[model samples]
Target: MGDELRADQFRTEAASPRGFRQVYVREGVGGVPLLLVHGWPETKRIWWRNIAPLAAAGFEVIAPDLRGFGDSDVGPDGFHDVPSHARDLYALVRGHLGHERVVAVGGDLGGPVIQDLSLRFPGFVERMVLFNSPLPYDRERMAGLRTRPPREASDYFVPQGTDADALAAELATPEMRRRYIATFYTSRFWAHPGAFAPEEVDFMTEPFGDGAKLRASFGAYESTFSEAARSEPTAMACPNPTPTLVLFGPSDHVIYPDFDRMAAAVFPEHTGPFRLRDCGHFVQWEAAHALNSAVTAWCGDLLAGRRRQ
Candidate 1:
């Protein structure tokens, strides 16, 4: 954790025209901007390990806690679906931050948001670095790929999506909610075993201690089961034209086992689909050095531009 970006020092809040206040970490000064989006059971803290390294490699890193997660507000409308998240980011980057183009990087739920961002607002995302994220199902292209998540690993989905209200009610207390989210970080095998120490787990679960935010975070899952719960940018136009670099951490039991293959099929302009050993769902933390090296190498031209200056 040497030179890690401290959330307390850099976190800032920007009012989104779309109606929520976005809390994000904006680091680095004038290099090519890259947005590092986090997914379910995670906050911007997930990228803390990789942020300083990436900024050092010559890129401005913007990591935001999607609405309803971390310190960010859930907004009056209470929509946390992919499209809604994408729109919030669109407004944050293009509208508030004033960056016309960005290199989008995300995993888990962030995967869909970036995908939707690239599709819904073409030219906004110049490239993408995706890992441990969801890919749109295409029958023909993903013919041989294991596109569906393993059933044993997916027990949390139905409960979270369909019974969000009841589930939230059942969890009841902050400690109960944190315990539930803690499983994804531990026994759930969302990360490679032994990735998180006890203190690290405490840091990650601290934000979930808020009952309201935890409940709002379930909206994304709910959108999948009910159309009525969807936001405007609901469907992502696949075969996303944006050039992408796909990295997979195979140890993750929660997502599609053949994610690398499936991602390659869906993103025609994709590179690598590289698999990192001993890594799992949380690529940034599990394989920090590798993830940092990959991102810097993938965006060499951008880093070089800064060198040329």
Candidate 2:
């Protein structure tokens, strides 16, 4: 896999006003600077498949490994909450990119982070694109986790005996792993039977092999949401005028089935919604071509207008 494509890394120090440590990524080139933030249990590597294509289409892309995930230094107290995460994002963009205004593209946990980033740092963000994220939705109404109690892990792979161990174990097993993979590809992932090349599956599974790492990643998810919900409302009081686009699989099981409604309520004025037929939560991975095309076209329109202005 290392021979297939080379990934370059850039390191920079970004601190939230609270003195919390934050690290982010900067990659790709062209068009407006676009920051791509990955969700829980995933690293900046999640953007591997999309970066080159987007860069080729003339868009500068940056996919950052949020705090407590990947190689970034973990915060002492762990700034896993939403506002802190968003603030970390704000610092990263402001301190590293040096662009007063840019676009943010996020999915899953990155979705809400970007949403808060847009609201909190409105002037710095010119536009937003959210993929299969649960933003501005009632926590109690979330579809998949509605009945389940909030997970207690601080990161993606919690230890087996720990509260989040079961989830970690499930993701590690063959059958549950297949189902988890299906959550991304939906019916199509199974169409080819051998569709998930062993190498591809290995790449996905490699990160979670270590129980400690897995637990930390799982814990990040649990910690971020609870923090976000508590602080997001106060931070998101003002309506965001930045033009935003939302794309999702209507049949997604991870996000609420009624996500469209949530998207509407989140960005009342500047939101455009697109539903991918038969797609699931991992739209970017499962439907890369479609997702890339949609984003490229939308970004093209925005960039062209910026030039015209």
- Lowest lDDT block of 10, candidate 1: 1-10
Per model, state how many residue pairs clash: 0, 14
lDDT of 1: 0.88
In model 1, the runs with Cα more than 4 Å from the true position are: 1-9, 307-309
Candidate 2, 2-64: lDDT as tens digits = 643233434333445435445545555445678888875466766777776876776777776
What are the Cα lDDT values of the candidates? 0.88, 0.60
Local error of candidate 1 at 110, Å?
Answer: 0.3
By TM-score, how accurate is candidate 2? 0.72
How many pairs of residues in model 2 come into backbone collision? 14
For model 2, state the Cα shift of residue 33 in Å. Answer: 0.8
In terms of lDDT, the poorest run of 10 residues in model 2 is: 148-157
